[model samples]
Target: MTVASLEYNGKPVVAEELTPEAFKKFGYVISPKDQAPKIPEGTYGMAYRLSDASIPVNNYGNSEFKTEAPCAFNLQRFKPPKALDRENKVYNLPNVERHPYTTQTFFPMGVDAEKAAYLVVVCENDENKLPDLSTLRVFVARGNQSVTYGAAVWHGGTCSLIDQLDMTMFMYDNGVKADEVHLVETSGLRIEYHL
Candidate 1:
């Protein structure tokens, strides 16, 4: 949906009408409500030790943070996947690990509209088949929604333009930990966002 607003000096000034189709053009998609994305039953990914031991001194008081070693953490950035390319082009956002509740803010690069449009969700310990998309609730993030995605929840990404988009993602997890080996079933659901 289109939310209208005026932008002059790089600040939100108004709200406008928005539709799922219009938003999808720039890679904004509605989170599927009908069937939850199928998360096959399995164990959490492997855990790796934080190489930087001294980092704890500075990070002690911090609730969450992006690891300094971007490469080490499988950190990734991408243009939101498009139509036929959906399944084959999936890109995993780095570092999903178990954690306690905490708040993290992320500002995506160059999304200019009255408000931002995207889908986000949180789920845990579910092995049911994914439901239909038409039956689901697609959450559109207008401004910063301090929503907490539970540990091991499957979620989607922010919408971005054709150009490179950088997101300062934050996580409120227990400590600096990275999970390895995300489990993907041999066969999976087909998700398509109307563009």
Candidate 2:
């Protein structure tokens, strides 16, 4: 329906550093920084293992969507939020969405890790499969980091802070009703970030 119809606990969220352990239950923080090298120091020595946790899941089974292209690898661009309060480094969240049948991933392209960042707001589902505001969490992700939203996880609109972010995105879709969006009526839901 409309954002005015949703319920939100009126409190702003201060974003914290994203880490694998902290984000494990929701999804993951994908990055190459601060990890021991996993490959032998020879041919593929440059490879530092990040994660293999992004395997797609079809909770509703794969037979629901009938289409030629079930998955898409796309190059996309995201600008700073229209609702961003740059001087205050805050972004007002209007809504959240979820892909109930597949995971979503974004890889930042040519982003300067030191200069720009983005906000990722997530919450767990309630017994009725609605956004549980009490469990909401916000994370500040650097340009060096990427993220994969686990299947059926609820997340606020992706907002790039400071500068535009170009990315490669991957997701499964047949252009149907499996993608869900909940309009948030919570007036104070926001992300407070550090510039």
Query: What tens-digit string does per-residue lDDT give for candidate 1 at 1-195?
Result: 111111212221122223334333222322222112455568377433323211111222333344442211213354654522333422222212222322223444344433433434222333442212222222334333223333333333444323444554544333344331133221122332332
Candidate 1 RMSD computed on C-alpha atoms after optimal superposition onto the true structure: 19.1
Task: State the TM-score for model 1.
Answer: 0.35
Off by over 4 Å in 2: 1-4, 36-47, 50-53, 60-69, 178-186
- Specify the poorest-scoring 10-residue window by lDDT in model 1: 1-10
Question: How much lDDT does each candidate structure score?
Answer: 0.31, 0.72
- Number of the top candidate by TM-score? 2
lDDT of 2 by residue, 64-125 (tens): 55553367788988888788898888887877877776778888888886545778888998
Using all chains and alpha carbons, the TM-scores for the candidates as numbered come to 0.35, 0.83
The deviation in Å at residue 80 for candidate 1 is 2.9
How high is the lDDT of residue 4 in model 2?
34
**The candidate that achieves the highest lDDT relative to the unseen native structure:** 2
